[model samples]
Structure formats: structure tokens, C-alpha cells
Target: MDYIQMRQKRFLIAAWAFMECLLFGGLLYGWGSLMYVFKHEGIYAELCNNNDQAALSAMTNSSSSVTDVTLTNSSEETKLSDSNFKGCPEQDSKFTLCFTIASALVCASSAVLGQINFMFGTRVTRLISMIIFVGGSLMLAFVSKEIPWLIFPGLSLLAAGGLPLLVTNTQVSNLFGKGSSSIVGLLCGGFDMSSAVQMVVKIAYESGISRQHSYYFLTALHSLVLVSTFIFLPKDFILNEEAMSTNIEVAGDVNVTTELPIELKERGDVVNEKTGGLKENNYEKKELPTLMSCVRQPLYIMHVFWLCILQLRFYYIIGTLNPYLNRVLNKDDKMVSHFTNICFYIMMGGLMSSFLTGVVYDWQKRCFASSRSSLRQNLMPAVLPLTIVSFLAVLLSALVLVPVQSLLYLIFIILTLFRSFLYSMAAAFLSAMFPSEYFGLLYGIMILCGGVFGFVQFALFTWAETYVEAPRHTDIFLLCLVLVSFLHPLYQWYRCSRAEKELTQ
Candidate 1:
């Protein structure tokens, strides 16, 4: 395709991918809302019913003077009531396991899928995701209390399948030139916002729509992935500027630099107009680093550390959202549901916040563009976004400790901003710091570490379940961890400044 046509197609594909990801990519993360339906459907209610029976028998055996059993002294603990005992710790734990496993699968599967995409091409990988997502939707559609176990595989498959679309779509951002970082942020935003899918389901279920019918609808909607795989997405990958420039040179389009004038200028290179190949101004292309070499760098290690810490903080909040809300809202069902929906609503704004993060990175690039020859200069742009994300994470961890109910709105806002930048910056850092060829593998491994850290949320949840002050204490602990994340950006800034000084000398 010619330049004009190529640009049009590029936009069309990017928009298509964005919508697809928004609808499916991270839907499982919307567990906050989806948990409501699962509870209504009584997925593990038998466990709760059985526990209630056991508790009733114990209370009958004990003295009538015993008003309440001490269930670990937590504010959210299940109570042994004389008249009725409705707390379902057993049921909630089971559901928590389901979400924990599903969310972990979403991240852990990334490395494997990245390898798959790298080896078999994007089409094959997406085809696999299509199968997994459709099967997951089908399983969820047929799930009932009798088949609660279906939720485990159903949610896991859905999370695993949806992630590929987000992973693959990051490459499409290259088509946008300087605004590519913004597009990366937007794609991450779409993935982040996909959590709203379950919120929509919760809203619909409240409107008298059955869970089965909703998932059935989602199944039908997910089938469009097949269409996207065959029609919209390419067999291999999107051509980035370097790859596209190579193609242009081979196609006899001599004015390669003219076609990408901004990029050419960004590298401090100029081309001859008349001769069509006669000039270069202070630009030298270096050999790309090997994947192993890139991974071994201090910067990469710190980036992974930053991701693991912030990710754990975010996942802990997500995993314990129900109990946390239940405790703070005093178990007011209607109010809890209202706030849960509102949290998802707040998450939808991630698209804007994420896109703005990319804009900030790109603006930083422009600000540092004059010193194109320095490696330190190249690294400076990334530091600002990194620092911003760390700061937001610290703020979120601190805010969760406050007992005031109204502060939840502010907490949710900061949580959304923190999450939006976390994933977007992760992708942006990998793409900018590493070669595109290994982007898939490195990106996957980064998330894999973070995913492993996500399991720690279960331990934290258990503690919160057992202790009266554990939730607040957990927040304080996570705040300390979040504080450590500042070291990554600090080191980056220090390294860059030191390198700049050495160059001047």
C-alpha cells in the first residue's frame, strides 16, 4: 500500500483493536461487580449453608448468654446469631480463590502467549485466544450452583484469552509516530476499562437479566474475535517505522525520510532533496542489543521491581474489595452495590488518564530531543512517568488506611490513575528500552513476575479476615512497599544525570 492508504488502514486497525480490547481484554478484573451476580446465583452458597448449620448447632450447645461468637475478632467476620446467621466466609473464600486464580492466569499466561505469538505469529496466538474466550463464555453461560467449579476454568480461560488482544495491540501504536506512546496508553486504558464489562453485567442482572443470558450475549460478542483475527489483524505483526522504512527502500520509494520526516528529524538526520540519497547529518545507527543483554541491565531489573511492588498493591485492593467495602459500609447491601458500580464507573475514566500518561512521555521526548546523541537523554523521558506512577501508588496505599467512608471516592480516583499508568508505562518502557523483536517475551516476563506477586493478596486477605485491624495494617505495610518503588525512578534520574555530566566533561 502507498503511504496515504497505509496511514488510513493503520488508523482503522488501531481503532478496531482498541474497541475489541475495551470489550474483552481485562473483563475478569471486573470481579468487584461480577461478584455480586455470583453471590446472587449462590455459586458456593452450599458451603455457607453448611457452615451456618454447624454454627447453629454450636450455638445451641453453648450458653444462651453468649450473644456472639468471636470469629477471629474482625469487623467483617461471620457472626453466630441466635435468630439468623447470614455471613458466608466459606462461600466468599471460594469466590476469592476463583478470582485469585483467574487474575493470576491473566498475568502468568502472558509469557507463554508472548512466546506463542513470537513463534507462531500473531494470527495463531489470537486464534488460540478466540477459542479460549468462547469456551470460557460458554462455561459461564451454563454455570449454576451445582456446577460452581465451572467458574474456576470459566474465569481463568476468559482472562487468559482476553489478554492476547491487549498484548498484540501494543504494536499497532507504532503507526501513530510521536503519539505512539499515547496510543499505547490508550490501549492499556482499553484493557483497564474492560473491567467495566462485568460492571455492565452486574447492572443488567439487577435489571432482572439472568447471568446465563448475559454470558450468552457475551459469548456471541466474543465471536467477533474470529473476524478480527482473519480480517483486521495481520498474520504476523504490524510494521514499525524501522521495518516500514526497510520495506519502502525495497519497494523503490526513494524518499524514505520524506515519508517519515518527523522521525528522521528526531534522530538528527537530514536527507538530500535533489539527489534523493546524498546527505546524512550527525546520525549513526548502532547495533541493537540482544534480548539477554537487555534483560540483564539494571534498568530492566528495577523496572520489574517497580512493576511487582505496585502490581501487588493494586491486586490486593482488588482481591479484598468486597470485604473491605462490606466492613466500611456496615454491610448495607444497597450502598455497597452502589459504590461497587461507582468504582467501575470511575475505572472507565482510565482511558483518559492512561492516554494523558502517554502524552506526558511523548512531551518529555520532545523536550529531550535536542540531545539526540546521548543515551542518557534517551532515558530521561521515561523517569517522569515512572515517578508519577510511584507517587500515585503511594497515595493510593495511604488513602486506603483512612476510615472515612467519603474518602472512598478519592481513593477510587487515585486507584484508577495508578492502575492506568502502571500497565501503560510497563508497555511503554519495554518498547522504548528494548528491541521490538523481543518485546513480546520481555513484556510477558515482566507481567509474569507481577502476576506471581499477585498471589500474595490471598495471604493478605486471610490476615484481614482473621484480625480486627488487619486491613488498615495491611495498607500501612503496602504503603511502605510503595515507598520503595520511588527508588526505581530515583536511580534512573541519577544514572541519567551522571551520564550527562560525564559527557559534558
Candidate 2:
């Protein structure tokens, strides 16, 4: 969260993600954005299901002349066709089965990693995750041509690294009291910004270089940063100033920064003041709060409820925005290119927000140090007004241009800026709601809620969007914003009251 001190790890994290994205993003997430290459070359697009007969069967459907090829194990003949078929939205119909099956398998790995993070100390887990992340990047750098091979390392490392990222934010929230929202926002914003930057790189490359070469080029380039991270990163964890500290003031009473601690055991590392070194204090573990227990607690419940609502809506709105632009805003090559640029800009803004979130959260902790014990009176008053004003402003400013094109473009730009800032709040604040121990789990729960609501929202909205089209789109987003901002205090008050009652009983 302390940008000047923590910038190295943050940069490595960003660079690591950028490479994974460049390779996989181009293939899947950014596939539509890079359609020309797939349409023309049919390179990795061919589906050769490792079996010789499956390859022969599919090939026979298209031709009599058999192209001789050696078949290996289950992975041998499996390959995607270069044909721009109607079935696959980006590649072809067969790819759907292949992608779905493979994605499911890799996601299983991610789920395992998620569980593992809760068991390890955050720093220890992060160290492991970083290794896995670096390994994944190296894999992508080497295996760009062999697409399936890329999946193994990509998902493996992604799963390994995912929890460490969330846990750090959770720790930040626990350490720094007030502006945790901003810090978490910064992380999320950085994520999206990285995506945006990758999109720009992808767009630029698609205009010139070959797809395989482009992916390889980006992967190799990003991996280059790993060297500096390894060299400069403190060999000893306790020696790192930022990592060891618990409190830092940013400005006035607006922000605070601190390091939250978690022990793998009941007693883990406790620092010796005299020596300025960490000494092992392993102790037997005690029972910790469960999800059910936490939910039954009032404060946690309120925190989760609002997070679910806001995060889901945000995800839903952004998800729909892309296709809506193409479908409604004139689906031309030029417009598509514009939308692509918007993606990059939005992400760039998010990247900047990631750093800013940490700074803002640090500031809030400084402001709220006096009332640290009172959950609502202490915490709510400071952030509630900002949250309300920001949301209302966002709603009013973002939607006004919906009915008009020139204004619409300007509104989109402003909306991107606000989204970067506000979304950072959503993430960091959620982390602030819990103690340090639950950081990874709590953050994951938030994302899980976002994911659930996200799916439902997309389904429902798409069904509704069949009839409703842009002005309606902007209107709905604005309406949701105003409503949430208006009602947050009442809802929060109720939740806070309920929590106090539960504790008393």
C-alpha cells in the first residue's frame, strides 16, 4: 500500500499478470478483438484431438487427401481448426467443448490453490505463488506455439498467485483502518488496467506481427522484469521496512497504512524489539471464526451484503458494456477499434488507481484512528458521505450522455475514471471489515458473491436487453447507483444494530 516502498513487488505482480494475459488474453479473452488473424491464417485454430483416428475423421470430413501426422498420447491429435466457423464465437464450435473441458480442469487447480492459501501465512504463500507465477510466464514464453501446453502453466500459476493478491489486501485492511477501500480498489483497478494495457499491445501487434510471434514476444518481455524483482527484493522478510510495519500516515485524518499479520500457527513470528529481528514463537492453534459464525455476526453480515450487491452490479454493467457498444453504437471496424482503445484506457486508469487506493486507504486510517473501536460511528461517518457523493455523481454524470453521442463519449471517459476510483473502494473497504486472519478467505468470499451475482445479472440483463437497448443501458446503471447511495446508511445502520444485538445476546 505504501507505493514508494512496495512498488517493486507491485510492479512484478503487474508485469507477471501482463504476460499471462498477453498469451491467453489474445487467444480467449481478446479473441474477438483479434479476429483478423484467426480468419486468415488458421494457425493454432485447428482442432486435432490427440487420437490419430479423431484427426483423420475430422480431416476426412473436409478432405480425402490425408495429411500424415504423428499421434502422441491423449494430447497427440487434438487440435483446433483454423476455419472461422459459426459455432465458435471466436474460434470454432469444437473449441467450445475443448475450452470448457480444459478450463474446468484448470479451474479445479485454482480451487485447490484457493483453499491452500487459507492454511499458510500470507507472506509464505505469496513467496510460493510468485515462484509459480514466474514459472507460468516462462512456460508461456516457451510454449506459445503449443497452445494446450500453455494452459497448464497459465492456470496453474494463476491459481497459485490469485489468493496471495487478495490476502495482501485483506492484511492491508486489517492493518490500516480507514482507507482500506482505496487500497483494495487500487489492486482491482491495476488488474483491469493491466488487462487494458495488454489489449493495447494485442491490438497494436495484430496490426503487424504474427499472433504466435506476438504472444512469445510479450511473454519474454514481461519475464525480463522477474530478474530485477529477485535481485532487489530483500533476502530476509523482517529486514523489509514496509513489510514489517503496522502503521503509516499519508495525509491529515484521511488515510492510514499498516501491515496486517497472520501466523500459520497459533504463535508464528514475533519481532524482537532489541534485536530488530523476528523470533519464532510457534504455539498451538486456537479455533478461528467460521463463515457461518462470521455471517451470524452483524458487522460481517452487513459488510458482505453491500459488497455482494455493489460488486455484482459493477461486474454486470461492465460485462454488458462491450457487446452493447458494438451492437448499438454502430458495429463498424472503426467503432470496434474505438471500443478496444477504451478498454486499454479504462485499464490504464485502473492500474493507476491500484497505487492510489493503497495511498487513500492509508490516509483514511490516519483520519479514523480516534474512533477505531466503534464500528459504525467511527468508520461509517467518514466513508459514508464520500461513498454517497461519489455514487450519485457517477450516476448523474455517466448517464447524461447516454441519449447523445458526443456527450456519451465524454461520459464514458469520466465514467472510466470514477469506476477506477470507486471500485478500488469496494475492494479495500471489504478487506477492512475483517481481522487479518480472514483476509484471503474474506476477499475470496467477496469475489465469489460478485461472481454469483455477475452470472445472474448477465443472464437477466441479456434477457431484458433483447428489448432494451444504449440510453436504457446508461439509465439502468445510473438508477442503480443513485438507489444504492441513497439507501446505504439505513441498510448499514440496520446491519450494525443487528450485529450489536447478536453480540449482547
Candidate 3:
């Protein structure tokens, strides 16, 4: 195969990975739509019905006549009608808890999964994720009111399993050379769009399709991933240009031989005189930077802090989205459903947002591209993307405070862009600043910290439950916290400017 063939193969692999991510990466985050279906399916409706029954019993005891008791019972039953039923606090809390646990797992497992990828290679990591995802989908498909608790584990596994797809896909950017950042952004965008799957599922459910069947359909789609894993993706990791040069077998022609150092040949590395150094497993043997060293870096610390505040804010907003919409829309279920669908639909725009951001980063990188510059200096352009993300986050928080029904459209639009930037830029920046060898580990740490911060969302949801205006106050608090994120960008900008000045001198 020639250059064109190799490039085409790489592009095709990247495109396929993008499709896989868009379809399955982060469906758990689409909680609003999925929760809507869950509520309609009466996953925890018994709790609400029992509360309704208790209310009925109390009313009967307080009534002086059978007619009054009958009227009260009729009204209660009518309100409990599944068509227009608004869930009780207890039921909503259970859903919130499920999201909290699942989302936490999504973030928390990043490092361990990254480690698995680092140690066991892409094939093993993807296989593990595939099995977990299939099992989770099956579990969710069979979930009923009789076993409502299954949602906890099912959702957890689903989220944890899907994340590796995103992690593995981001590395595909390595194939694109200068356009690598853009590729990373596009892939993250696909992950963002995965949230729309739940939106589709909810729409299907409203159109007479069952949640079980919808999941079964999704489970069937997993075959595409299984096929891609074995056929397209590298068994270990994608080799960079230097590594690629060392392995002549990569181009499907083993006639060429590249001599290896004596040290390597003595270490049981197979150096064929006819076929060159076919050391496919040698990529895994390369030493990566220590995890602690990466963690202790000021840049990593600031990035984690930057990601955590935004992640917590985003998670809280998603976890309480239904209640917040209900409160704003005066519990109009129809309007709430309409807006929820619109919100998720807009989330699909994350792909465009990420692509544009990646373009911006790549363009800026071209401007700053210098053969003499240090890696740190070359990465200075990333500060602009980071700053843009911070500004968007602040704007999103401010918009959340307005509570106008009509503004939700604009809010969702901004939300999609902001979220796309959040994850995409985080990955892009880390990959640009750190060694590719450490990218997985560092990226996982960033995600793990952010995921841990996500737990705070439960507390905020509790506040919203306890106080009618708590969401408003929470928005205000988030706005303030997001303002702090500006510090990371500002500091980076200063560093970039300083580095430029030194370079000029």
C-alpha cells in the first residue's frame, strides 16, 4: 500500500470511530429524556402512588361524608393518571440518585480504564468496554418496576463502558497530523451527540415504542463496535511516525528491513533480516512519564480545577433539569417534554461546536508553529480556546438564572457549544501539552477529578428539593464559581505572552 491508501484507511477508521462515539458514548448524560421515559414507564411510580394513596386515606379520615371522600379519591386518581402525571419528590429523588451514581462512575472509571488501555492496550480495553456495555444494555432492557434497583447498576455500567470509546477514539487524532486537534474536537463532539440517543429513545417511547425494545435496538448496534474493534483499530496502539518508520510491516510490505540497535535485538526483540524489526509489542514497552509528576504540574492542577467547577455545574443542571423546567414552566408536562426534546436536539450541535473550536485551535497553532519553540511554547495557542470556554461557561451560568421559558432555546444552544468546548478543549489541551504516552493517564486524571466533583451535584439537587428557589440560588453560586475558572485562562494567557516576549528577545 502507498501513502494514499494508508491515509485513506486512517481517515476511514477515524470516521467509523466518530460514528460509534456519537451513537453510544454518553447516553447516560441524556438523563432528561431517558428519565422522562422512565417516569412514564412507572419505574418508581409505586412510590408516588403510595403517597397518593396515603393522601387519599388522610382525606377520607378528615371528610364528614362519603360524597366528599369519593370526590377526593376521584381527584387523586385523576392526578395520578400516567398521561399527565407529575412525579412526587420521592420518585424524582430516586431518579436523581441513579443519575448521580451513574455519572460518578462515568468520570471515576476514566483513570482505571486509561490504565487498562495503557497496560493492556486498545484491544483489551475495547473488549472489556464492549462486554460491559452489552451487559448493561441487556440489564436495562429487562428492568421493570419489580426490579427498579437494576437501573442503578445498569446505568452505571452503561456509562462506564461507553466512556472508553471516547477515550480510545481521541487517540485517532494522532493520525491527522496538523489537523489532529480538529479531529479530537470532532470526536468529542460525537460523544456529546450521543446524549441525543436518549432523546430519540424518548420520542420513540412517546410514539408507542417500549423502552425495552429501544434498548434492544441499541444492543444490536453494538455489533458495529465489535466488528470495528477487530478489523480496523490497531491491536496495541497507533504508532507515531518514528515508530511507524521502525515497523515496515505496517505498510503491508515486509520486504524492507530497518536495523535495530544491538541492545534492542538482544532483548528478545525479533529483528528479521528479511522483514525488518516487526516489534509490534515494543510500543507498549516504551516508558511513560510518571503519573505523580504529571499530576503535580501546575498546568494539570489548574486544568483539573477548571474542569471540576464546570463539570459540577453541568451535572447539577442536567440532574435537576426536569424539576427546573417544571418549576419554570409551572409543571406543564407537555411544555416540559417539548423543551426537553429541543434541548437534547440542540445538544447534537456539539459536533459543530467542537469542530469549530478545533479549527480555531489548529489555525492558531499554525500561526504559532515554530521549529525552534519548546513544546510549552508551541502549546501557548491553547490558552485562547481555554479562555473562550471559560467565557461561554460564565454565560451559560448567567442564562440559567434568567428562568424565562422562551430563553431556554438560546440557553440550550449555548449549553451545547459550552459543553462541547468543555470536554474537547480539555482533551485537546492535554494532548498538545503532554507527551502522547502520558495523554491517556493525564486525561483520565482530569476526568476523575471532574467526576468526583460531580458528586456535589446531588447536594445541590437536594437543596433544590428542599427550597423552591434553591435552583436560582444554585445558578447564582455557579455563576460565581465559573467566574473563578477565568483565572486559569488568564494565567495561561499571561504565560503565553511572557513566553512570546522571551522568544522574541
lDDT of candidates 1 onward, in order: 0.79, 0.44, 0.79
lDDT by residue for model 2 (60-100), tens: 56533433434559755433343311111223322222233
In model 2, the Cα lDDT at residue 251 comes to 41
How many clashing residue pairs, candidate 3? 0
lDDT of 1: 0.79
Candidate 1: pairs in clash:
none
Identify the runs in model 1 with alpha carbons over 4 angstroms from their true place. 1-4, 50-87, 247-288
Please write out the lDDT profile of model 3 over residues 1-505, one tens digit for every residue: 3334546788888889999999989888798998888886768887786576654454345422323222356554523445444677888999999999998887888889899888988889999999989988889888887998989989988998899998887777877777889999999999999999999999998898988999999999987897667777777776444335554445454454442322232233554444454455553333434667667877779999999988887887788888878888977667889999999999999999989889999988877776233433455678789888989888989988888998999999988989899889989988776656667778887888888888888887787778777778878888998899988888877765665566578
The segments of candidate 3 whose C-alpha lies over 4 angstroms from its true place after superposition are: 1-6, 49-79, 242-288, 370-376, 503-505
Candidate 2 vs 3: which has more TM-score: 3
Position 144, candidate 3: lDDT: 89
lDDT score, candidate 2, position 146 = 47
What are the per-model numbers of colliding residue pairs? Answer: 0, 41, 0
State the displacement of the C-alpha of residue 108, model 3, in Å, after optimal TM-score superposition. 1.6
Return the TM-score for each candidate structure.
0.86, 0.58, 0.85
Question: What lDDT tens digits, residue by residue, belong to model 1 across residues 240-314?
Answer: 675455444334434453222212323434554433332555443333445676677787889999999998888
Candidate 2 stretches with Cα past 4 Å from truth are 1-114, 122-189, 221-292, 351-368, 371-373, 376-378, 385-403, 464-489, 493-505
Using lDDT as the yardstick, the better of models 2 and 3 is: 3
- Higher-ranked by TM-score: 1 or 3: 1
